[model samples]
Target: MDVLDFDLSDREFWAKPMVERRDAFDRLRARDTPAFFAEPVVDFAPQGPGYYALVKHADILEASRNPEVFSSGSGGATNIIDMPGEFAEYFGSMINMDDPRHARLRRIVSRAFTPKMIKQFEADVNTAAAKIVDDLLDAGPGCDFVAQVAARLPLKIICDMMGIAERDYQFVYDRSNVILGGFDPEYTGGDVSQVVPRLLNAGAELQQLVQDLASYRAEHPTNDLTSSLVNANIDGERLTLQELGSFFILLVVAGNETTRNAISYGLRLLTNNPDQRALWLEDIEGRAPGAVEEIVRLGSPVNFMRRKVTRDFEMNGHLYREEEKVVMFYWAANRDRSVFEDPDRFDITRSPNPHVGFGGPGPHFCLGAHLARREITVMFRELLRRVPGIEGGKPDRLYSSFINGIKRLECTF
Candidate 1:
């Protein structure tokens, strides 16, 4: 078979059609190759030792399940090339740590998402969904669904959770888009250095905001999650100011971005497959749960996550050396033919849909996963109820290999 370029970080490669990319992954999986070399420098990082692309479902599952072997804490979870010391720690959040540290951080964060907390958030979620649908109705006929509808619910829910003022919603949203979509022309364009400065600046701005709020929360706590995070402690295990700032950034980006993209793609997927749309509309409440999973499977919002090999290990007849990077292609794994029969087909009623859209089976599986599903379900249910005829047009996608984001998508009812 001809060589397939597994350099997922390449912007041009990401810009290619989705079908072409999936076809390339299919060829790689068919080879039964344990891993393939990835370019060290793709977007803007300095040259370094390359990583391996983990394409198959089984391999990704193995890697994710064995976090000690394929460690996310060793270098950084975000990229194949290890970021600088402070930056890596800040961006990684709990995602980049192992053992006691990871366990401790997760416990503190989990406190914020306890059954009581989630139950309370449900009322807020419903209100947000209603407001979004109402605003879409006011706008009438057509609008940029990504901005007007898909983006609003998650952004509002997260901001409200943090007790942020309504006035600063756009400010937080803009910075998040910049941080996640810096490569896209709409957010940042030109040289790599230019992009880096903007990215750092965005991170700094968010840090300042979170730091200020956290300080206030410490003095006078509230019922919101920001206060919980600020005052969160478990047996003297508490997040330091820097850790709090980083976790805030993760919440803004991951909390808002993942669900936003999923909702955006849900509309697009349903638009493309009217039969499924009808299938959903026929019994909106009944189909929503499974339909949400199918949309997540197809969208695969966080395209891939990177892990570092701490020690040499063998898997699927290939040996991974110590300190080497192994990138789990979650997007590719979600479509594994072995995992999902006729994986390309958009079947809303896909039973046993074990897609790793929320990362593979691991300790680091997305914490906001339950919240995300509720947001998607509530928002789509609102859409089907209020604006059943809404149809999504072509998407203007984000120019990033990491996030499968929709920068803008027009929808008409």
Candidate 2:
């Protein structure tokens, strides 16, 4: 096989180990290159500030904890088009931003994800999960768990929240499939130069819906997040059409994709770790919550987060020029040997869990954390209760290396 061919197929062909760091990353650092990131031997310094991969727990923690030093403003390690500049202009959601500005936008969105708002979402989530599970249960014996349960459940929940119609759910699903189709085996494929425009068009459709919802809120206000966002005042300024558009897109992306990955990964983890799965099944109360955290921490869906270095600074004895990019390695950091004991083992009973499965500290802590935690917790609770004999078949992982996730997983229950 060609050198490139060997790199892609064999995860263990790296310098250290596949989980520890990629060979490309080590080579860069060995040559004293400023930054490093993972690859299957695909070596092209990513667009954004220069970075050295932060694999150790302390390093990831320090970087994530200190936004001013490890600023998200610099917009690191991304593709040509998806940088924060384009994202802010095109969509303007808070995830693509740094603090001060990020804080203001986050607060506006945070109002809707509060304790009460999440509690209200439960009835809807339970209702959605129950119905989907009922259908899958009848289908019986063997099927793609991702399609039947994990993928469909969150897709339905988000659609309901957006107030989209029954038929439109499939449309929403298809668009999201394309967006996430960047990873896994593609249902459809093309050049990113072309596909990005298509993704943007999909984003535009979402924006238009937000605009309509905003207009609706202006005329007749209600309790929906869209309505709340439409009516929100930011420093005596209402959110612009693009802002609303961005927020809704963030909602759908964050809402559907991460949850889907977590659930799918959770099932796969459990199926493989039969001992861990038994612990969950045996301990009804405590282990259930613990299992959710364990699966999510192990899964760590948002693999690498990009940050734009706002100003020049020195760290660990090296100087970085202003606007240099930094990439936080979530996958490596989650399994950081320093923080997590027996990091590779899938122990469901793990506690004092300090994994940064969610993004790191500062103003950028995920807004939907409570909602996400509850959703994952409940999803697992219901899933294990029903799919008694669930076992591994095959995991159809996503095609994108960035948004590492499973798109389809075959399971036998």
Candidate 3:
């Protein structure tokens, strides 16, 4: 792991305007950092405390690996929900917790999302994906792919895993969008007083849904992931309600939002790079594993994963004390030239690509990584096969600093 400069303190460094802060993050997609180190260091501290943004791949990996120093408790992940009150304690998910505790919770749910479980999803995911693409084909020519396809695929996966009815999908999806929309827009839709009440409500509904499914599974077992979660064992104790709820939070945020953004944005990347799309179409192997990797490398759905410094620590030659926060800008880091040969050019086949689009490099890596890839891969495979010459339409960004991707991508088939 290494470090790179991205000081956000200087006003001149950021060309983006404050008014457009809520707009689609054009700043990131519009350009890449120049030359070896990428862009100049950005100073993110505004009107309050100061923290560094790791722009280069080396620095982001450095911050991600040394979780002890760059702890999440100090504000490792940027959030508007945790500014004060009970929101901080209540809204903290696996992503925001440090090693020991994060390890415990993650370990329990980790078994359910393993490679085997994801493989089971392949048939179902492919089926659902084919249906989505089929629907798009019937609709034809002009369609809002984000709403009709990208958003639906991930939501359906989460609901299917939890055994929730299709009717209730909107509640979880809508709340999740607001819950994760800190930088994009003020969460005016949901209650802003705290995240606990909202979380508890969602949890209660999910628990009931799972319990019903558990009863069904007991009498009539299936190959679905829910059966696995219900049967999970942690030190011989079955998962508590709190742990189960946390799993739901991760599923909705990570499984649904992240994958949706990746697919939608991945298409945007392809549309912009017709040559690359042509390569994928023309190639005998057909982009193999590289298409998804390259797309994710460029369209990083998870903008930044934050953590606070626990004890005094040093990064990229800068020193900081405990309680100080730092942001690992995965979006910026994945395009770092030091790591990728041609960072900005979206080649369909870029090997040895070790990008951190899955949140971090080490153990605390995204639990839903396999599910996300399956979701994106299935969608793209069906999309390219069914709809010919399709391209992205007027894209509407959700405008969030965390949990980013396309909210609405108009498309012409």
Query: Which candidate leads in lDDT?
Result: 1
Clashes of 1: 0
Q: In candidate 1, which residue pairs clash? A: none
Name the lDDT value of residue 143 in candidate 1. 84
Which candidate leads the pack in TM-score? 1
Work out candidate 1's RMSD over C-alphas: 1.6
Q: Candidate 2: TM-score?
A: 0.85
Tens-digit lDDT string for candidate 1 (194-235): 777788788888888888999999999988877887887678
Give the local distance difference test score of model 1.
Answer: 0.86
Rank order (by TM-score, best first): 1, 2, 3
Worst 10 residues of 1 by lDDT: 34-43
Residues 44-125 of candidate 3: C-alpha lDDT, one tens digit per residue: 3223355555566766777778877777755425441124333333345667677787787778778768899788777889
> By TM-score, is 1 or 3 better?
1
Candidate 2 residue-wise lDDT, 274-333, digit = tens: 888888889756787778778778888777776655577776566766755566767766
Worst 10 residues of 3 by lDDT: 34-43
C-alpha lDDT of residue 5 in model 3: 35
Against the hidden reference, what TM-scores do the models get? Answer: 0.96, 0.85, 0.81
After superposition, the stretches of candidate 2 with alpha carbons farther than 4 Å from their true spots are 1-50, 75-89, 183-188, 234-237
